[model samples]
Target: SRGRGFGRGRDRFFSSDYYPYPHRPGYPWAPTLSREDEVRMLKSEADALKRSQKEIERRLGELEKEE
Candidate 1:
């Protein structure tokens, strides 16, 4: 029967902002940045992550040597 679990309909799907569909008409559906800008941003983030990982590894090495 049409209770709390059955036949709730499609209204629930579009209620959240995280839904895949656009919330309103004429909204920009794609990234505004150019391909080069996106690539540069990603590369910078990756480099920062790599540097942090290297620092962690170095600290671990020092701790192991002390033990």
Candidate 2:
């Protein structure tokens, strides 16, 4: 029968367009930044986090006062 052919079930595993692995040829690696650039990025992230934390604390205090 057609379903019993040797090539019938092979396309799912060995198809040309199938990507069974994570190694992509067109994908790029992360860029390497200088020490100063890395420090700047971290500092900006820390500042943002600190601002968010302060906002969250203010909201929590308001909720506690209402309770």
The best candidate by lDDT is: 2
Score every model by TM-score.
Answer: 0.52, 0.59
Which parts of model 2 are misplaced by more than 4 Å? 1-27
Over the stretch 1-67, how does candidate 2's per-residue lDDT look in tens digits?
3432356554534444546568546757989999999999999999999999999999999999999
Q: How does candidate 2 fare on TM-score? A: 0.59
TM-score leader: 2
C-alpha local distance difference test of each model: 0.73, 0.78
Residue pair clashes in candidate 1: none
How close to the true structure is residue 33 of candidate 1, measured as C-alpha lDDT? 88
